[model samples]
Target: MSLRIEQVGPASSARLAAIHATGFDRPWPANEIASLLHMPASLALAAYDGDEMGGFVLVRSAVDEAEILTIAVHPDLRRSGAGRALLDAMADVLVRTGVTRVFLEVSTANTAARALYDRAGFRQIGQRHGYYADGTDALVLEKTLQGSGQDGA
Candidate 1:
């Protein structure tokens, strides 16, 4: 499939929310997504297959550090490289803005996501107990940027 990743704005909140809802059990509302997108520190990227949104990644950066707030891919489109592309696009944007590291939390039970992060060079740095709505532990992972030649970019 041909997937194009692009920086998105508040106007794309509904589409992001829709795609997010399809991937997660409890999705953020469009207004919440819009509000986050409107924040000065917030950045979002969306992956589109032509006119349809396939996935997205949202982040908040502060100084040289950034945290991935959320990442989601359409249920029917998982494992198709859209997630990796979104991450790569996000890293490209982050590097341009002087970000040196990116961090995110994934559920301990999500082996697929954990594997994806591992393959992307993220290392486990910590963990949070009962961090999810379902009382699952969250594994905190971090990836240190390596110049502008990294895979994600």
Candidate 2:
């Protein structure tokens, strides 16, 4: 459980793209990941087990709120706490960046992800029917960070 979560840059886009492909039906390409890395207020983090990539999360901020654009943990690393580590680190970074609230969408059928979000203190705020390409419903969740607007100490 020695997962090290670090902020990532565009140079890791290709690696992130590769890791993303493992969990996504339509994973983003390296160029697209690079584009996101360059966007204003966008940030990405990678969780590593020593030198091995465990997962990654990408988010974008607007005013006092942030949206998780995407998050992926390698199938082999699922349930190994990598996902939770990534989420905790994301919140810390957001709080320092003045992001007070965070939002994300998870498939209604994704019990694993839903459980994680629930344990992380996110609440269901909305739903989008047939939001996925496979016609699965998506549940929108939100969490407000405590002690937000702090310096990135």
Candidate 3:
């Protein structure tokens, strides 16, 4: 069960979309993922198990702040450390890029995702009512980077 995390470029959009579709009820299309990856301020990290994509995390950075666009793990691979590896890779990139804070939104009903974010040091910062298609409120979580010393100026 060797897992490797890699920074994914636009060429890997289809693979990212496939894994995302398997993990979520609604997934972004490959073209959309490619467009996001083409953005200079955005990045995507993928966790691969041998030849298969296990999970991914997409992020957009602006100055010292960054937002997690989305994160997902293959349904069959959840709780197998893929999610955590993707997140750890994401944080490593953020720190290296001088991002000092990161934000994400999770459905209040998605206890698994909330637990993952909580374990990654993110705390509830705000909320949005009826933020999801199913009317589930979204909990906004934020984590501030510590000791990186990069101002992101």
Candidate No. with top TM-score: 1
Sum up the clashes in candidate 2: 0
Sort every candidate by lDDT, greatest first: 1, 2, 3
Name the regions of candidate 3 deviating beyond 4 angstroms.
Answer: 148-153
RMSD of 1: 1.9
lDDT top scorer:
1
lDDT of each: 0.90, 0.89, 0.87
Off by over 4 Å in 1: 149-153
lDDT of 2 by residue, 2-99 (tens): 88999998999999999999988889999999999999889999999889987999999999999998999998799998888888889998888778
Tens digits of per-residue lDDT for model 1, 42-111: 9999888888888999999999999999999998679999998888889888989999899999999989
Tens-place lDDT per residue, model 3, 1-153, is 899998889999998899889867788999999999999999998888898888899999999999999998988789998898788778878888888899999999999999988887888899999999999999999888855522222
TM-score, one value per model: 0.95, 0.93, 0.93
What C-alpha lDDT, on a 0 to 100 scale, does residue 9 get in candidate 2?
A: 89
Q: After superposition, how far is residue 141 of candidate 1 from its true place, in Å?
A: 0.5
Q: In candidate 2, which residue pairs clash?
A: none
Q: Following a full C-alpha superposition, what root-mean-square deviation does model 3 have from the true structure?
A: 3.0
